[model samples]
Target: MIQRLLIIFIYFTGVSNSTAGQGQATLVVTGSVHGQLDPCG
Candidate 1:
């Protein structure tokens, strides 16, 4: 569980950082994911 959460955190952080631009908002919609859905905690 910890490992999976870690991977997700790293992935999202990397993606948001790379894709996000100045004065821009990143709309990340995670769906169709089994096991853990919605935001963690």
Candidate 2:
């Protein structure tokens, strides 16, 4: 039981970290596109 819990905890931590990084990357990409297209606005 303890091993299972540890595995789950590690899995979720990794997923969360990857997801956070992806979210940040997406935001940066979108922001760059927006800035280019709406430079005059």
Best by lDDT: 2
How close is each model in CA RMSD to the real structure?
Answer: 6.1, 15.2
Model 1 whole-model lDDT (C-alpha atoms): 0.50
- Per-residue lDDT tens digits for candidate 1, residues 1-41, read 56776676666667667645312323331432334565653
How does each model score on lDDT? 0.50, 0.57
- Cα lDDT over the full model 2: 0.57
C-alpha displacement of 38 in model 2, angstroms? Answer: 1.1
Residue 21 in model 2: lDDT: 65
TM per prediction:
0.46, 0.44
Candidate 2: residue 33 lDDT (0-100): 51
- Error (Å) of candidate 2 at residue 4 is 46
